[model samples]
Structure formats: structure tokens, C-alpha cells
Target: MSSARRHILIALDMHSATDAGLSTLVSIARRLDATLSGLYIEDSQLMSAAGLPFSTEINYLSAEERILDPEELLRINRLASAQARHLLEELSARDKLECTFAVESGKVAIQSLSIQGCDVFLPGRSRKSLTRKQVTLQLRQLVLIYENSGIFERMLEVARLLAANGMVSDITIVSETPLPAEITGKLSIEDVRWHFQAVSSTRPEQLRALRLNSASLVLMPKDLLTNLTERQWFELLEQLPFPLLLMD
Candidate 1:
């Protein structure tokens, strides 16, 4: 686990909603007194596809088809990166929190995971979500995937802060085994209820199946996700309706 003064990294893209990730990030940063960092990603694969002579672009809102131009895509990425940096600068100035920003060209998820020196990673909503029906994320109940007492301790700290900030009343622990006494003793918060969701293991399929509607935020430790590949992590984040925070 990282120290309270560790860095919190946020992964963003052109379609990202800064408010969703930054609000949570700022809250946690203030609570932990941590520094903030932003990573703006440009999809290299999309840029390559746009370079194809026969490649075409279709408007999601309108049914119009147009030629995909790599140069235009690159320009758009630059604009998005500029906008992201501006937002981070504003956030840093407003919150008086240390902030850093970087732009990388590659697979968004892979690039984010490859970054070093970050203690915690909060990935913004997937760009694919733009085409789907939007669902409101209310922080009423939080789902935490428990691995062990050590990791759970760290997860609980953030969960508690989020619960307090979001006025969350219940927190559910999804675990393969029952919590030991050492772990259960920590769940005695006043006015906050705790529940458990049993799973066979922390496999990708089981974890995906446990996405209950009541959960507004899901917290999972990076240690428990040893079975997931980089691509799987990307897909998982893309499919989740609510945000998932991964702690190292």
C-alpha cells in the first residue's frame, strides 16, 4: 500500500467527463493529502485506421458517412489534450493541490497501466459509453471487492471517505471467503450499514456478474486482479456502468 502522500493518477480521453473522476479524486486527495496527476490518451489505433485510404467515419448522431482523415484526428487529439491540461490547472489552483499532466499516444488502458509512480488509478468513463444510454451514478451504496485484511484496510479508508462524502448508507463486501474476525471488527461504523456478497473467486466472470445496480462505486485492489490481462482490464472498465477504482 502507498502512503497517504502518494500520487493519485486519473486516466482520461477525448470523451471523458472530467467532473466524474475529478470530483472523486479531489475528495480523496483532500482526505489523504495526496498529489494529483492526469493522463490524457490518444488512441493510436484509431489514428492508424484513419490513415487508411478506404477508411470512413460515420457520425453517431447523424447517419452521414465521411472520409476519415488522420490529420484531423491528430488535431482533435491536440485540442482534447489542451482542454484536459486547462481543466487540471484550474483544479490544482482551486483545490490548492499539486497536479501534473501528460499526454500519451497508444491504447488508453494499456498506456494508463504502464505508467509508474502512481499509487492509485482512477480511470474515467470509457469513450464507448458515449453511444450507449447513460445511467446516473448515485453514491448510495458502494461495493468493495475484498482480497485480504491489508488491502481491505486501504480500501476501507477510501470507501469510508466516499461514503461520508456521498451520504452512502450501506457498503457491501464481495468476497470469496467470509471475513475473519480481524476484518469484521472494522465494520462497526455508526449509521453506516455493512453487507457481504459471496463469490467463488475474484475471476473476471464472477466479478462481472456481481455488478449490482445498487452499487454506485466499486473498489477493487490491484493485487486481487492477478488473473486479468491488460486487455481484460480494458474491457472490464469499458463494460462497467459505474466507475471502478484500482488501488496498488
Candidate 2:
């Protein structure tokens, strides 16, 4: 619902992979003719640990343990945030992606939910999974979970651009309900298809069976997540085997 126009969000962090992925992000943006946005999340865990009286840091260069107070953490966060924003500015400039940027403070997963008004979400990296089985994300398919038929056209339009990104093999819609007539009227895809997964009538399980995909990008509507607690969603973002995107 952001615009009749399309928008895509790309996340950034202190990691090098984040900057490395900007070209890929811009490629998708250009293909969709979508505006772009970047969100740099301040790590809440590091901040919390910094505030503890017993907090300490190990000097990676010196191999020494040192005090890591809140002040130091804040300083580190400022530098990291600035670097992230700079990268966003530089890479988004490679194309006319109509890019914008922002910064937020919280647990990364929790903080990312604050980003709004976008069509697709791309996490810049395949972050560590809590499951710890060393799973890899497959970016060859884009999975979308939509709320209603009204958003169907927007979904497919975004899907088309994403699928041609050299990695995505196709688009898949995981639906609990039948397609509304308006959507079905215009829907056709050579590779894109809808897969049915049953859910509790009152509470749909849109995120279910998602872990089966090895290295895919899974997208969902931000407003349609009715069955999960914030913590549950945060954990899902952290532990999912693939890159997860949530649209607003």
C-alpha cells in the first residue's frame, strides 16, 4: 500500500557482504523500476552488553580483554551506521533507484519490522541461523505470501523482476485461501505458481513449510502476520534457512 509505484528495501550492516550485495540490489531495483530504501540496524545485544557493569571486550588485534562500556559501544555503532549509510548512498547511485536511507536501534530482527512502505524485502546477507546445521540460502526462487487479491498485481510485477535476477528460478505463492476472481482474471505465469498449504481457519500459517527450501528468498506481507508474537517473528528471521523478506 505504499504507492501505486513499486518500492524495494535492502538492509545493511557492518559486514562486507552487505556492501558486496548492493549491485544485486540495484539490479533488482532497476528491473522493477522501484524506489529503494536502506535500513541500518543498531545491534541491541551489543548495546545491552555494553551497559552491564562486568562487560568487557577482547581486542581482536591485540588479543587482549578490555572494558567495553556503553560509551564505547555507542561510538562503535555510530561508525558502523555511518559506514553503512555511505555504502547505501554509493551503491544505490549506480542506478536511478530513487534511494533513501535510515537508521534504527534495536535487535536487528525486531528493528527491521519498523521499515515500512515497500514491496519487497532483501536482507543483504545470509545471516547465521540458530538451528546451527550450517544451512545455505537458495536465491533461485522467490516465495511470496499475500494477504488479498487487491495486492496480487503488485506482487506479480515485483515477482517478474526478481525472478530474472540470474538466480531466481521462479516465483511461488503460498496461499491458504483461494484466489479472488479479480486476481485470477489477470494472473498467468510461465513459471510462477501458487502452492496450497492448509492453515487454521482463524490463524493462517503462512511461514510454515518454508524451511524446506535450501537457498531461496521468501517474502511475506507485513500486515498479514496475525499468528506470531514479535519474538516469534524475530526468531524466524534469525533462524530461517533462506533470506526472508517482509513487505509493508
Candidate 3:
């Protein structure tokens, strides 16, 4: 790892901005001697819809329809952002790390990828559409998405760091091939519990089989998603019920 300071950016949404995720990021920041920051995205789609006279909202429980007030949405956005900032501040203070946060108006992924200086960008998970239960962040089962590239090492390094801070019982690499002996040997010597799951390919379906609830963190290389269109990118995220550590 470089001795120079790095910046870690976390993208936040209303449903998934939990303290557990923020604490994990703060721990990583402490390990890397990096600064921490957050981006709270106000959904552009909802905001635009509010401008239309026909836009209305239905209560999921009450089945009642009402006009979608832009003011109400803006108020909700500000409240969410403030709550996120409060969580970050509380963790940063407890960890003795400097942290900051901001609000952005756009799609979460687009706004997240637009920022260039962050060494690690965590694209926040929106509320999952699937009926499966969501898992809280646990650093024990570290999961890394493998690409035949140099980014795996970086992913492993971050995973190991999390292991050191938390009780990481096992590390799993989702790759088509086994890791090089050099890396595997080090893990063995360190007595770290680890395993590999072989896949025929890195197709979306194969990747999706490794469900989000079982792992503590999913380390995905940005290059693997470089070819994904905006819609495709969102589809992948929607399936993930946990925070995704997007490695650049």
C-alpha cells in the first residue's frame, strides 16, 4: 500500500445508509490513513416526477393516493442527508478520523462514478426488490469478485485489513481459477480461513448466484463493470442486498 494519503468515498441512499456500513468505511480509512467522505444522492427521477402535475404517490400500506409534493420530497432528501452526516460524524469521532459529507442531485451510480479522486468508491445499495432478507455488514466472510487483473491484490489487501479490525472467519474469492500459489501460501501461513468458488465464466448470471447476504463485503473491480450500460449496472446493484466496495 502507498504511504501517501488516500480518500475514500461512500455513496448513500435513504434505505441503505446504515451505521454498520459507515463504521466499516471508517475502519478502512483509519488503516489507510485516509480521509473519509460521503455523497448523499437525491433521486433525480423522483425529483423530476414531482414537477409533473399528474405525479402522485400511493401509500403502500394504506392504498391511498395523494399528489407528490416537491417540497415534501426535498424535505425528505434533506432529512436523509442530515441523518447520514450524523452517522458519519459519530463514527468519525469515535474512531478519531476526519470525515466529511455532501449532497448530490442525480442517479447514485452516475454521481458516484463522476468523482475522480477517491481511491475506493462504495456504491450504496438501494432497497432490494427481492423478497430475500437483507444481511447486516459483517467483516467475517470477506468476498472478493475476481478479475484476471492487478485489482485482485488491492481487493485482497482491503479484505485483509477488514479482517484485522473485525472477526473475519473466512475469505472467499469468486473466480474461475484458483489464486496463484504465492498468494495462497501467504494466507495459509497466516492461518487465515479462506476458500475459492469456481465459475465457468464471469457472466452476470454466474456472478449473481453468489448472493449478497452471505458475504461481509463484495470487492468488485471497476474494470469488470466498464462495459456495463447504465441499466445493466443498476440491475447488478439492485440484486446486491449489501454495500459494494467498488475498486478503481
lDDT of 3 at 122: 59
Q: How would you encode candidate 2's per-residue C-alpha lDDT over 92-167 as one tens digit per residue?
A: 6766558888877765544555556665454534443322122212346677675674555566666766654444
Q: Model 3, which residues run further than 4 Å from truth?
A: 56-67, 121-137, 189-191, 203-207
Give each model's whole-structure lDDT: 0.69, 0.59, 0.70
Ranking by lDDT: 3, 1, 2
What 10-residue stretch in candidate 1 is worst by lDDT?
127-136
TM-score for all predictions? 0.80, 0.68, 0.82
Q: Write the per-residue lDDT of candidate 3 for residues 145-209, one digit (tens) a residue.
A: 77867777777777766667554667888877777877665564154678888877766535567
Comparing 1 and 2 on lDDT, the stronger one: 1
Which predicted model would earn the best TM-score? Answer: 3
Write candidate 1's Cα lDDT for 1-248 as tens digits. 45546677777777663554556555556656678888888988889999889899787558799998898989988997898788677767777899998888886666665666565455445333321112223446778888874767878887676666544678898888988898888787667888988888876546558755422667787655556676786666655555666676
When 1 and 3 are scored with TM-score, the better candidate is 3
For model 1, the superposed segments whose C-alpha errors exceed 4 Å read: 1-4, 57-66, 124-137, 164-167, 205-207, 212-215, 225-231
